[model samples]
Structures are given as structure tokens and as C-alpha cells.
Target: MKILLVLDNLSSSCGANVGIVYELARTWVERGHEVYCLTRKDRFHDIDQQKAGLLHMVWSFDVTEDDILNNVTKSDKWIHLSATGKAIFELTHPVFLQKMIDKKFCESSEIRNEYRKQIEKLFKERSFDAAVAVTEPFYIADALASAKVDTDKYVIMMDPYTNNPSTTDRTRKKKLAREQHVFESARKVFTLDFVGNDMNYLSEELLGKRVNFCVPKVKKCGAGRSDDGATVVDSEKIDFVYVGQLYEDIRNPELMLKIFTRLPDNYILHFYGGGCEQIVDKYKEILGDRLVIHGWVSSDESALAQQNAHILINMNNSIKNMLPSKLIEYINTGKPILNICQIQDCPSIPYIQKYPMAVNIMPMDNDNNIVTAMISDRDLETMAMEVQAFTENYQGKIVEHDVIENIYSDCISENVADMMLEEMQK
Candidate 1:
């Protein structure tokens, strides 16, 4: 079997998107199938050659230097209208330049045309059994949908549309339209969450049909230690570790900071991602030695931190249906989880509640008052007690790793690949 994987960005390490793509490619190769990947050249240039070799071919696309220079120096004076004349140029020039800048000098029209040309060339060059395209940057998915290929195409919808909040009305409308187009055009759509027997209303509303939702498999990182044989946590203090992006609105770091300040001196807070620099600086004096902020660490270091921490924290205050990729690694540790959510009925709540070692904290009320209430001395004290109790009870306890693992084994890339192959064959 021959498979083609399309992604906008592929990092060297095991990031959320990269990990899924890499694992699928590796699985296909190990199963004696050929694989090809198409992605941006500049971003994925440094991928490990040996690991990349598993794929039969990796095609990268980028704007050439000549194209950049030509677009920069080219004048738009010739593009004039009879009625508006120079006024049209004044209004449209800025918009054109912005589009060029926003698209990294490869204009949308050029990208679509070039990508179509490339896809056509590839179709003529070789045959493919199936293709999988990620639905971010929707244009790539649009391009793949329109390609003149004979294979069945699948769109991997990692995050549902309901979870994405737009800044403006126009942006929201555009996103919705693009999502609708991609979902409707694909042969089959797959999501990373196991939405279970209950249908995902948003997905059905968008696609006009039910889609496949698969849980993600968790890979076990060796027993909670780094290569140097040193533990990832401090033995004296109770370490609370968080490892992922800290968006101000969605995954607020402010609430975490407020909670950390009110906690007891024995507790230490560690942040291991970008976007919390401003918050860290603001609370530096108050936090003093209790806060350890490592701006961004490699994927391996992230796994090490997850394994060593006494407790793992996830703050999803805004998004309801989406699950953070870091949660999988956190659960793999068999340690207790402190999941802070804005809504009581978040999709993750049921799953987290089922895990004996995990605790789900939802706001008492449904409004912003929850933030104010959560930071109160009384509320903070209660939370701290809960954490203490959970840690004491679950410490050194052995969880049924296989039983937990069984829940997600079907969602692994190998299984997903097999499903795709079967679907294509049918």
C-alpha cells in the first residue's frame, strides 16, 4: 500500500501534530507500506534524516528567493479601474501587500496554483492507495480536496470547530465557511477524541453527518527519570507541573498564578511552555522561590517532567470539547491529575472522573465569578487540602496500566492506518 500524508508543519521532535504524523508514517513503513509526506520546507528542514527515511519520499514546498524579490519590487500602478482610478490602487495596494506578508511572500493564489500543479505532477508520477490531510490552515486541506488524485482522502480534525473562538465576526464567519467546505469535501473525517455513543452535535451540524472520533494512545516513557539518573522533581516540596501552551483566554495562566500564590509554602509550581513569561515576571516577587518557569523545553524533557511531578495540572478554562495533548503523557505517569475546567459538563470530565487518581475541578458558578471565587483564601485552602489528600492516598499506588492502556490502544496510528487502508479498499 502507498499512503500520502499532508501536513503544514512537521517538527523534528514528537509534538502533538508531528507525533501523530511521524508515528503513522513509521507504522506504515514497518507494515511494509510506502509513505510520502508533503509539508513546508523551511519549517521541517531539520527533521532527523534517519527517521525521515522511513517515508518513501518527503516533499517540501516554499517560495523561491526570486519570487520574493519579484513580488517585493513589482508595482501595482497598472492595476487601475476607470471609475475609481487611483483611489482603488490606494485601497487595494495595502491589502495586496498585507496578503503577501501574511502568506510569507507566497500569495494564496500562487500557493493554490503551485500546489495543484505539484499534486497533478505527483498523481501522474506514482499511484497512491490513500491520503490523509490535516485540517489546520484549511487551505492545504482545500488544495488536497481539489487535487486530481484517484485515492480516497481523509481529513484529520484534531480540534473541533466549537472549541475555536474567533476574535472578530468576519473571522468567525470565514472559519466556519472553511470548516464546512473541508468537512463536506472529505471522503471521511476523523477526530482525536472518543466522543462515544452520544453524537457530537457540532460535528454533525458542520458536516451534516456523524464522523469518526478516536482516542489517542499513550506511549509509556521509562519510569519517571531523566537519562542522568536524577529525579525530575524536588523531594522536599510538592511539585505541581504543567507542560503546554498558556494562551491568555483559553488556558489562562493568571488563574494558575493566583492559585499558586495562595497555596502553602510546601507546594512548588512549575511551568514548561511559552506564553507565561509576562505572568511569571509579574508574580516573580510574590512567588520568589516557589515558582520554577522553564519557558520551553524539548519533547523528551517534557516527558521527564511529567513522569517526575507529584501532580499534573491542566487548566482549560475556555475550550470545552477539546482535550490537551499533554494530558495523555500526564495520565501515563499514573499520578494524580488536577483538571481545572470552566464548565461542569466538559467532555473530559467523565473520563477524568473515571480515573481514580484524577480530580476534576469545575467552577461553582457558570460565570467569571468562578475566577474570583477560586482565588479566595477559603477556596484555595480547600483545594490545597484536596490535593494533599489525593497525593497521600495515591502515592506509590500501582494502577492497572494495561487496563488504562486498553482504552486507547485502538486509537494508535497503526490501528488508524489499518482502518484507513480498509476504508480505501472498500
Candidate 2:
């Protein structure tokens, strides 16, 4: 069985799209399926390095940075854009800059052609049984879909590219024809979150093409439990660690900022991710060293931090359809998780509710009074106490048993491998 996966990074800590596909690809390899990958040169992970010799073949797209300090910003590897195009990107809000940077990269012909050639080369080497194209960068999917490979091609959209509310109408118009081709080229399409799955009608309406997007429940992670001694675990303190980007208006850290101060001084909150500039001082001023801010970390470093933390924190976007990518890593940690939902039906609730050591704090609910927004002092205090109680009482970790074992094998990856074997048998 031969399967080809297209994504940004194979690193679990890179984000959701990569992590989900990595677990799926890993399982297929362990089952003796031949798996190949095309990813960003800089975004490759060490986990795959250990498995590279016999397990798989990886063709990284190209270097996105001189060094990884470019990190999520992508400022170093950016080329081909006109001077004005680059200047306009500088003015984009820091919260949204990383995303726009990605869009800009996807707009590059040079990068796209390089990926197309590699995709063609791989297909030329052997006809793949299945081609799974994942997207945060929609162009990669476009490249994969546009390929002349005879395999059953599929597209996994971790984000709603044409329908993203943050994007302007002009951008959507520019991308619609291109993305419709990608979706139409695939045998099936998948979205990571169910909310997005429900919005397939919206995508179809926008694309002017038939589209059926299903949510694949591949949330289990096989990586990210390694403790490299990178984090200094304080046995005397209770630490609630949050990893991922922060937004000023959208994914604001106001709730996390308020909650930990209510706990005893021994309870601390550590933040790890980008877009921390606006609140770094505020974190110091309000919590005064109790809420530690770790601005940016490598994928390996991010894993170690989560492995060492007493509690993991996750926040859902208000869009309702967009789920946080960090939830996968948080679940993998097996640590008690404190998930703050910004809306009533936050997409992460279903997954969080299933975990034995997880709790959800939403904006409003009859059963829970957990919103940090303009609630009375009493409600705020009660919420704070509830967090402490939940944190202290959980003794069990979320182990491998919590995952749906047959999901990948019974669904996409396994189906791909089996169909190929069936064809060979014929």
C-alpha cells in the first residue's frame, strides 16, 4: 500500500492538521503500508527522523527560514512578494499576521511550482494508492489536486479558506475558483472540527460546486509525551500551562489572567506561544510573576513544557467552527485540562467532555457559571474555586485507552491502503 500525505509540518506540536495526519500516517506505516510525505523543509520534526530509515520517505517542500527563529512569523523566508506587498503585510494586525503570512507564502509561484515538481516526481516514481492533501496553506491542496495522479485523492481542510471571516471578500473571490478545483478534484473532503463539517453547505454555496465535508474524529496523538527536562517542574506550585497564539480581540487571555490570581499564590499559570506582546506587561502587573509568559518555543520545547505542567489550558475561537489545534496536544499530555469556551456551543466541548480529566468553562450555561465577562464578584470567585477543586481532585491521566483505536484504520488511511491492496490482488 502506498499513501502520500501533504501538510505543513509533521511535528505534532506544529498544530492540528499536521498532528492528525502524522498519527494516521504513523499507524499506516506500523501496519506495513508505504507512506511518503511532502512538507516544509523547516517544519519537519525529530519524531519522523527516528522513523525515517525504514518507515517512510519525506520530501520537504523548501526551507521557509534561515533558522527556526523565523518560527511562526515566517519573516525570514519570505521572498517573491513585491516591496509594496511586503510593506502591506507589515501593517497586518499581529494577531492575524501569521495567517496572512501563510496566505502570502501560498501565493508564491516559485514555492508552488517547487511543490508541484516534487509531487510530480513522487507520482512519477510510483502510482500512489491514496493521496491525502491537508491545508492551512490552501495552495498545497490546489497543487496536489491539480496533479495527474490516478490514486483516490482527498483534501483535509483544517481551516475554511474561502469562507474565513477574517479574510476580505476580494481575497475569497481570488481564491474561490482555485479552491473549488481542489475540492472538486478530490474523491472526498474532511474538516477537523464538526462545526466546520456542518458548514459544508456554506462551502458548496461559495464554491458553486458540490461538496460534502465530514469531520474525522482522529484526535488521539501518538507523540508529545516526552519529558526532555527542558521544563523545571515546581512540585510546590500548581501550574496551568497554555500553549498557542493569543489574539487581542478574538482569543484574548483576559479570563486566564483573572482566574489564577484568585487561586492561592502557589497556583501559577504559564503561557507559551506568540502574540504575547500586548499582555506580557499586563501578566506581570496583574499576576506579578505568578503568570509566567513564554513567548515562542520550538515544537520539541513545546512538548516538554506540556509534559511537565500540572494543568493544560485551551481556548476556543468565537467563530464556533474553528477549533483550537492545541487541544490534540493537551489531550496527549494526560494532564488535567482547563478548557475555556468563549461561546455556548464551543467546538471543543464534545472532545473535552469525553476526557476523564477535563473541564469546560463556558460563557453561559444553566449548569455552569464560568464566564469571566462582567459576572458578579461572587460568580467569578465561585468559578475560580471550581477550577482549583477540579485541578486538585484529578489523579488519573488520559492514556491511550481514551482514544478511538479503530478510527484511522476503519476510515481514511486504512481504506486507502486496503483499496490499493485490493487492486493489486485483482
Candidate that would win on lDDT: 2
lDDT values, one for every candidate: 0.63, 0.64
User: For residues 363-423, what per-residue lDDT tens digits would candidate 1 score against the true structure?
Assistant: 3444533454345566666656666676666543434555556665654456776665566
Candidate 1: residue 408 lDDT (0-100): 56
Over the full model, what C-alpha lDDT does candidate 2 score relative to the true structure?
A: 0.64
Could you give candidate 2's per-residue lDDT for residues 10-32 as a string of tens digits? 55355656655665566667778
Per-prediction TM-score = 0.79, 0.73
lDDT of 1: 0.63
Question: Which residues of candidate 2, in runs, are more than 4 Å off?
Answer: 10-14, 42-48, 61-106, 202-236, 298-301, 365-379, 395-426
